[model samples]
Target: MKYEFIKSHEYLFPIEKMCKVLKVGCSSYFKWKSRPISKQLLLKEKIKQEIISIYFASKQRYGSPRITFELNVLGYKISRITVAKYMKEFGLRSKLSKKFKVTTNSKHSYLVVENVLDRNFEAKEPSKVWVSDITYIHTKEGFLYLTTIIDLYDRKIIGWSLNNGMSTKETSIAAWKMAVRNRKFDKGLIFHSDRGVQYANRKFAKMVESYGVIRSMSRKGNCWDNAVAESFFKSLKTELIYGNKLIKKEKMELVYVFKRKWTFS
Candidate 1:
């Protein structure tokens, strides 16, 4: 039979109290507790810690399979199944993607500007042409609407905004402000976008006009006209937005993500 001892009993009758409570002698308990850890046990503990460190460093994207491969690359010889068992013990798993849809209001009476871009996304320099568009991302909360303006020359996203609702003010004005803050605009600099109400809105157009930038818009129902913006949205959605789970939609979300994405470039 197994027995447990209490500290209160230790002060009562010494060995007699311990033997009565524990049903084992204090000397035997001390000998067992004082035994040094085996070499094999120490090695196993070290390996377990190493595996845990690697698992967390991967940002939880890697399950045991990928972790096993990564460990091998790092000069660790371990079985794939063993890694899987470790990951399961640690509760590590990959994220799953959710479905998202586009929300561009093309059906409006707003005057569509000419397709000045003409599928020529390249620019000689920044501010010569800026392509803007809005894309949607799915998050656990709901749909996250993203608006971005990219420099045609460098394909760099100069400005962006993220919000829970698709409002005109939510898309263009915030991005325009960011762009103006980043770089000075010159006369004849073309600001191109699709015929969405956000771009065609009088307030947005006036803002662009104030900068002396030409307002260029895609033709009705034709996405190819604003191909630069379209392509940027496609790449962004494919590479980043689609894979990320939207926990909360905030203005600074895209800014933070883009900063990291650009760093990797």
Candidate 2:
């Protein structure tokens, strides 16, 4: 284990010095290197290479546990701890979003409705209750705002828009337009979102009211009221956005997953 760590950091530190600090003899280490490789050692090396391939293929989003699960599915009988140890030896770690950026700003004079959904995440039928939210994706150039409308019935993203601005027209209005166009506006369908100005502004309210649908807003400073949208945002950032490669804005274009219907600008 000590030798492996030393080998991993060899370029950063001196080998003889590392051997002395680790209480390992330089001659002994070289002897082990010159020894013939056994089948067991060969298998271990192959598995280690596979671990590296899986880690990078996931864009460094997967941790030791998830990688171990994948390896087991691929017929490798390895433990999670062993995988974790190998990853640590190679200084391999999952990428995580290190910074926090607030996207919800409820400091507007617009009216906000009551929490009609009321922590009820499930819906009985399609278009029963649709929740919308906004999240920021960090990129090399700047932050990108992603607005999504999800149907609680199937937990699918029915409509979405990605823009550089958080204006009502770019964020909420665009997503809502796509949603109403794709899904039928049913009676008693509750539209839920946070108390952001984009959702509560007069323009958005008028558009939603015209459809004869119910309006719902999460309570001020209470995220649990819109738990579904908040949780979805968290998962999306962690699994797809955060810790991934920094995307350049000019070259950015996302293909919508639903039937290749629309492209997100």
Candidate 3:
């Protein structure tokens, strides 16, 4: 206690004077200060810092296994078990997104194509054409719906929403609002999507039309009409959602993470 007090107030008062007042030997305090930190402790601290660095660098997306692999790649002699221990010590964890029990619920036989993009995926410029789609993600808790609006020119997700339901308000309208907020568009900008109920209903169409946006829907039987959105979801499944399960995460955080990745990728 005496040594601790002296160290705590060393900057504010002379160390020797504090030691003298506390009836402790100055030499004892000096000896403690001069002792070298153990090599193991030093190495432990270095590993801890590295763990923290990699955790946040991935937006908490990497778990112990990945972090351990990264450390080994960087020449750190560590094991996955040890990494997990330190992760627990620091209260670090990766967010999860799991479960695939269902598919999108857009099974109305509406063979409507207001303006057939006709597989013309190319966009002359940004905001001139935007494509939208929804895909399911499996979670231990339940299924999740990820709706995205991508500017075809850049193939970037300009707007997105993560939801537990496929309602128009939760899916298409929410995503379109975000897309408009994220990018400027003029009248007659073509907004293309599958003929899902969320995008087919009057509510969603009215929302898009209010902004002077043109609507385009995929044909009755062809999946290639909105290939841009389909391709994005396919890649997402193979790359991020195939084998490993993402621990369940908050819906909002998932949407934000998706937006950040596609916005800059």
Candidate 3 Cα misplacement greater than 4 A, ranges: 1-111
Best by TM-score: 2
Query: What are the per-residue Cα lDDT tens digits for candidate 3 across 1-265?
Result: 7876888798899998898899989999999878888999798899899999998876676789889989999899999999999999899988654544444445865344575576788987888998888888776687788898988888888888888887889889898888888899899898888777888777777777798887888776567888888878865664455554563646776666565556632
Local accuracy of candidate 2 as per-residue lDDT tens digits, 93-209:
988778778888998898989988888898888898999999887778887788999998888888888888889999999999889887886677899999999998999999899
What lDDT does model 3 reach? 0.80
User: Could you list the CA RMSD of all candidates, in the order they appear?
Assistant: 12.9, 6.1, 14.0
| Candidate rank order under TM-score | 2, 1, 3
Each prediction's TM-score against the native? 0.59, 0.66, 0.58
True lDDT of residue 187, candidate 1 = 96
Alpha-carbon local distance difference test for all models: 0.73, 0.84, 0.80
Instruction: For candidate 1, write residues 56-100 as lDDT tens digits.
Output: 665545556666777889777789888878667677665434564
> How does residue 218 of candidate 1 score in lDDT?
78
Find the number of clashing residue pairs for candidate 3.
8
Question: Clash number for model 2?
Answer: 0
Please list the residue runs of candidate 1 whose C-alpha ends up more than 4 Å from where it truly belongs after superposition. Answer: 1-100, 243-254, 263-265
